[model samples]
Target chain A: MQTKETIVCRCEDITLEEIKSLIDQGYRTIDEIKRVIRAGMGPCQGRTCRMLIAQELAKYYGIPVGEVLMPTFRPTVRPVKLGTFAGGE
Target chain B: MPKVKETEILIVGGGPAGLSAASAAANLGASVLVLERDEKPGGQLIKQTHKFFGSKKQYAGDRGYQIGDLLIEQCGNNPKVEVWTNTTALGIYEDGVVTAEGRAKHLKINPKKIIVATGASEKMITFPNNDLPGIYGAGAVQTLMNVHGIVPGRRVLMIGAGNIGLIVSYQLMQAGVEIAAIIEAAPTIGGYLVHASKIRRAGVPILTSHTITEAYGNESVEGAIICKLDEGWQPVSGSEQDLKVDVICLAVGLSPLTELCFQADCQMKYVSELSGHVPVRNEHLETTRPGLYVAGDVSGVEEASSAMVEGRLAGISAACSLGYGEDIAPKLQAEALAELSELRAGPAGQKTLRGIMNLMDKGGAVC
Candidate 1:
């Protein structure tokens, strides 16, 4: 049996083991995982890890992927620096 | 506060569509300006090494990057067309005002017309352990190997049989990476048979009706488990097959990035055939809101060939509306539409036709 040490969320460096452990602890939805471990809340802004986490939760619950609640996406869609707004950058 | 800029025609995105629009509009004697978010102007066109497939007018034999450069060169040569690299159009505000962040200065542009040509983003697939570091979207991998000139991994497991997956698989192989397998949930390969054959001749097995069940590794992607799917697309429990791989490339599809269009108050509708919600535009590529237009993937998830055609249509329409090139506008738009219709007449284009028809039937094409 392979232990989960592979990284799922690279930005925050969250591991597969950590995610599975969180799931085992009964965090069912993606929102719950984001709440517990911050997998999707990162600099890349979940563009990389969002679908992965959503599908993982869907698979773990043996549900359709479309059924998984996606985290709400906000705009500033492309990264805009706060400093750019303040004339600092 | 940044200085406000004014132009006759303002185009967002500097890829094939935007550049084509700039060239067309500027050639018609309208002052055109293009704002691209990237440091360079090619968009994803820079990351493509393969020659595109279309008629000679669309550069059927030339490489994608070459065509991109050609578009830029011609557009750049137009005295009336100005391109600003590293410029991101933040939004198209009400009253036809636009705000953008430029490399050297922030810009508030008031243009006579606006065209949004922002392209699409890669779609992802779900599988157990998909979050592993080695997993990547086809676009990301293309950007890595094709754009940055770095091989992403030693071995790749390609998911989906679409053009991006097929093309990227070949591009990776050309770059000295081994492909373990290409698994598609569809019974038949999704892309052109020609592309599928090229990979097949290279000794890569095309596994149809199969899907990745999970990817497993401790530190990175070391292996993947694929399984055959039943009629309902559920994994057939006993058909699990594992393969050793370092990277998993998902080339499922692309969805149009219509955020700017939405911000501009363009009506959007969910059309699965077009790869998701796209801005509703009339025959001339004009959206419901006057003076605002859309082209490229932002209008609908179509090929670069069609994007260019649509761009020319919008460019000509906008230029004519502003009292430039009125005599030739109708002929030019008709030719663009004809070329687009022919390009979409292939076996691959039937679906696009259906998608467009579906949208039109649902009033998504109202303008």
Candidate 2:
């Protein structure tokens, strides 16, 4: 139960305690948590932590995990250099 | 703008599904281009060393990697199929222009029909210290040991009793590593009894209704704490057990990697039965967006056998839409559908069948 130190978002080093506290403080959605705590903004782009966060939110609200709306996935799904988009080889 | 490369059918993610699609479409005289993000053409199939289960048409008795090789060979031999490795499909535009990043350059491909066989990603569970260096997804462990010949750890604690968990545990033992125990949150083992018995005979206990609570390590995984779960799935008090383990392997489940479908503005429905959010598609596997299709895990998480069948179905369907294989397309399509229904007729395929029904029942834009 030492959740205060249990890391949830490995990229941003956010902890489970931080996520739960955010849920308790009315930050219920994964997108909201990402905006506030930078959970899904890392290079991995939430591949690892988004679902984990969604599960937490679903648990707190006593709702099914699928009911939670996943955040929008933007273009260039993988991280690419600006030059790549500029047609540079 | 650089001149956009054009093809009749473009398949993304050259895994079992993508390669199969490429072959199916190319055999029908459609110019097929496959974009694979990895260095090699085979997707997860390359790392799976276990023999597959299914009808003989799917190469059931052959090892998974061998089947992958067969699919790759078929595509390679077909002059109509062009596979580009180390090329990542960045996005699917509304205008039907697919942009991708090749080994050293950005390339835009204009294909008349697109097949999104991007596959799925492993699901993770929530537990304290789960992010330690030694902890990894089951697929990652397979990749390290089977593909690269590097053992992950000396002692491993596998979480989940699904087929992947059991198979990976057996594979780990094959690589001369010791498994502490295999734990499952479910009350009963979820994988085939055959796989379960293989590891059980090896003396690795399968602890059902048990879950890992925390991993103990500073720089990496050194140990873990597991406990029995109650009917409500909450950890039972006073049932915690500590075990010395160097690696924690998670084989919880997989969610379809549908980011490309979402980017393409395809209508998506979250079917838990499918394992996660999936794009709504029809019997032919074409998505809400015309000229766009999804095969394999991107449609729903299922066995590789089913993924291959789905790939063939989507490939022929996409090719048919492009006016290729006019005379033989219907018969091939029907055969693929029958084979799919047969694959789903077993007890294991019921969940996938239900998931597909849920998606198709709520009809989307006609392709």
Write the residue-wise lDDT of candidate 1 on B96-143 in tens digits: 888888874557899999988888878765456767789999889999
- Give lDDT for model 2: 0.89
TM-score of chain A of 2: 0.85
Using DockQ, give the best candidate's number: 2
Instruction: Encode model 2's per-residue lDDT on B1-367: one tens digit a residue.
Output: 6789998999999999999899999899899999999988889899999999889998898998999999999998999999999999988887889999996688999999999999998987777787888999998999999989999989999999988999999999999999999999999998889999999999999999999988988788889999999999999999999999999999999989898898888899988789888999878898888889999998999889988989999999999898899899999989999999989997778888888788777745353
Query: Candidate 1 overall Cα lDDT vs. reference?
Result: 0.83
Tell me which residue pairs clash in candidate 2.
none
Candidate 2 CAPRI assessment class: medium
Q: All candidates' TM-scores? A: 0.87, 0.96
TM-score result, candidate 1: 0.87
Q: What DockQ values do the models have?
A: 0.18, 0.55
Candidate 1 interface RMSD (Å): 4.6
Which candidate wins on lDDT?
2
